[model samples]
Target: MYLVYYSVEISNLSENKQLSCFMHLQVPQTPTVIPQELNSATSTSIAVYWAVNDGDAIDCFQVYCMEELQASKDAGALVEEYRVTVKESHCILEDLEPDRCYSVWVMAVNGTGCSLPSEKAIFKTAPAIPTINAEDCTVCWDTATVRWHTSSASAESFTLEYCRQHSPEGEGLRSFAGIKRPELKVSLEPNVNYFFYLRTVNPFGTSEQSEAALISTKGTRFHLLSDTAHPALQISSKATVIHLPEKTKFTGFPSVLGELLPARGCHYWEIIVSACRSYRIGICYEAISQSSVLGLSDTSWCMRCCPTQTSSLYRFLHTGVMSDVCVTEHPARIGILLDYSGGRLLFFNAERGLVLFSIRHKFTDAAHPAFALEKAGVLTLRTGMELPEFVKHS
Candidate 1:
């Protein structure tokens, strides 16, 4: 190897003498891995930048790129190789294939010749438009939790648009700022199909629109399995909503009952008492005694809220006993999770996200959802996504 030297001339003022010193410096070594601007990548180009940190001066840089071998299929994808030499610290490679991943590296060159290649930087060119297969998207009750993955991760943010099939276009999707995790929660129609789409945007530009995603929400679909509802109580034709008479014949007894016979598995469901003056919602076994109220039966489990009377309080009822809970609020929905094999019944205040109470019991047989309404109001079986209290989903 040949050695190159650098000389510096210095003057000693006190001694009135001039001296020169010669020093040998190493050639520009390998450059650090180039930083890629993934968000700026397009179907045909990508921008990469590097920082200068070597002790020696850099004459120029050469950026090398090649297409990555994809899984399956042969490795004969005629990838046009790129060998760009530039005096600047950055370069924008052109004529790249869309949606194709590529391996890139850079080397620094100076008077001593070129340095070793840098660590490879992997990236993919974004498509003209965002694309989604809508793999993990789900619809529950009157709300749907939508999720998807883009063909390229270059997108900085996403715009989701969704609406039920029967409604006019552009009705429900809310504004979400970041696209890091591409997820959206929106209201939908129960038992009805809906359509949705997605688009990605970055500093470069907005990508093309994603294909329309289609799904259906699980609407109120439970039926009354037992004839325990009082003859006076008005049950809806769908068997999901119930109404108590203006003057309730019984104060704490069941106003309506459902036929959900859960033999196994952790069952989950909810009921909305937004318009009710008072309600007692829970699950009960078939052998539960028919009495003044469901709570008085040893075989029944329930959470009660009496809002109409002077002393309207929230209570948990089981085994002919009552325990005081918190005062109930409007828009209050009750969610019940009964783990038969686990021998536990968990109750939640959907409006507050509070675990009001949980009961552990060895269930003897199958159980069903039960309701007791006091005064005039409607209790609708909520067959939608049980939302957290933080979400303002009407």
Candidate 2:
């Protein structure tokens, strides 16, 4: 990388020879020439070995490495360098191509300036397949990532292949080729098992297939019921994100409701709450009155988290009443569970799993997710959206 410097220079007048103190600078002596060698080489890394000269004010050294080209010239486009100030006389080069030769040069750097580059040292690493770090491979909601470490400093790029783990043979895996980054982010289906494998590629050859890493995306994706959202609220395309803009006034209510109101079985969903003064999240019947606040109606059940002047807390709200329950630390997420057949509605802190409140109601109609944001707020649908929908509230 090229560096930009902002420096102020003062010039002395040649004709005026007034006696004034002049600052002097002493540049460090350049490092002496020495034979350089490659040591302890591996498929993913190469170490450069050299000697330091005496009586030199050396601060650190910069090591530059690049893949060898057919003709002898500077590989300007592909060169990657690492700078370090450690007292050691060697540096390890990582993420290189396997079974490929790399030309490397090391130079000393001090406060004043840098020394001339040392003679080039040639090194070739062994070939080996990359292995997945199962612990580092993870999936959340809709995004999944695969992470691995390799020493192939000479590698041109990598190839990543993946597929649903349960798919049949000949279906084959999906392939993403010529990727230069070590970590890969992939979009995957929710609730599906995925198998991922990697191969290191270079001008020399491709590495063998690595052991497949397994991950599963969240099972459900919740979305707002669309038209049911209050005019004061704004929803994203998928209805997963709800935002309340500032400098706005509400004529109706300030809330939105999610679709897929089910009539039977237990359903659970999570929402991430952020940047709000007060909010309500819970379940309500499709016939619930929208003219009034959510919890003040007969068919709705929800939890309210409001920030007071001195503290932040949450409580259950319903039928013109607020539960006396007080939570000290504010929660970033909330979970709602609606069991229509069992006549149960529950709310809890999503992260700590502490039940904020639960109400048993004989709900006779379809139940939908409800939200109310009294201030500028953002709410994201976390999970739970698998249901057959047939009803919508006006």
Candidate 3:
């Protein structure tokens, strides 16, 4: 019966209604960030913005991020962080990490809490695209080393690029650019076949190429085949030159052939004679016989030249037998190595390193590279070379 005791002082009316609900619950007022949307960043994503400052006591928004540790001796033990939570005021964040440098901030949140962080900002991202370990490349016969990789630490430079896998689209492409190491050596041309790739620059941009890698360089590449020449021989629209004009007369065997010979390795080439009286240079068996005569056939092998007003008479034919070699000097650049699985076949005089003849035989078939001019001269076909440390130590 003391309901009247409810003269209620219920603790001063619950302390005046908890001080009027803490004066309408405050706690949101520090947002301002903004300064990293350089067109929405990218390479993994970033974006972020701010400015709100008390938008009706917020109620959402957090962000945060960090990173920015490009090894200042592993800055503060590799700073990391990251967070998110949005509801607007901008936010993209995403898997990020490419060419990094971040920092960011923001905050806001509400049910009466969070709101003090907002000044940091800074940013970078955008520089991932490397990949090109093309099985770690290596080559050699003219050089090649290549190699690449990048999840991005903001690659500050690197370009590479290449071409020659049938060049002609931007013709022999080639590029190098700043390059800050991810490996590179390049020079290549012996046996060519290239195609490489890899881009990734920075200062926040340039990356979108990597993923090509083909590489071949090692030795052996062919050229002359003007429809298997001999209509008085003339091939040279890039068939690597060969001419015979002094009144072309060939009842059938002024020969010419090339473009095959790589069933194995070790090859080398060159030829450049102009001022001739007889010529032969050799390798054959593409089913020889167009009225046959290069080295008198057994499927060919040669080295003839014959000019003697007192200066050039070398021989070494095959099958029609002939041997006579004993020069001391008389070479207009001839070189030709071919080791096809080691059955050897040499003949250099290439600028007087002198050695003019060698043969061994054992090849079973598929071989080509033959030529014969007999009179009017001019043969010129150099081909990707590389195999001379004196022909690999003789």
Estimate every model's Cα lDDT from 0 to 1: 0.68, 0.69, 0.74
Query: For residues 157-250, could you state the per-residue lDDT of candidate 1 as single tens digits?
Result: 7777766667766566544556556677666655577777777766554455578876666322245543777766777765677887676565
TM-score of each: 0.40, 0.43, 0.33
Best by TM-score: 2
Better of 1 and 3 by TM-score: 1
Off by over 4 Å in 1: 1-221, 248-254, 308-312, 328-331, 384-394
- lDDT, candidate 3, 1-394, per-residue tens: 0011112233566555532221355677788887764435656777777888534557788888887776554545856698978888887787876767788888887776777888898887778777885545545356667877787765777888888878876576679998898888777776777888888777655666877887777544467778878788888776778888997666866778876664456668888885665888888877777678888767888888787786677788888766877564567788888776688888988786667677877777667878888888788877655566777777
Query: In candidate 3, which residue pairs clash?
Result: 99-154
The clash numbers for all candidates, in the given order, read 6, 13, 1
Alpha-carbon RMSD to native, per candidate:
18.0, 20.3, 17.2
State candidate 1's TM-score. Answer: 0.40
lDDT of 2: 0.69
Tens-digit per-residue lDDT, 1-394, candidate 2: 1232434344565554444444433344444333433335556676666776676667787777777763555655565554445456676777875676778777787666777777776776655777776445434445566777676565667889999889987998899998888888787765677788988776545677888887656333346766888888889875678899987888867888876454655566778885666888887777777776888887777787778776676667778676756667777877776766667777766677677777877877766778888888788876633322211110
Off by over 4 Å in 2: 1-220, 385-394
- Candidate rank order under lDDT: 3, 2, 1
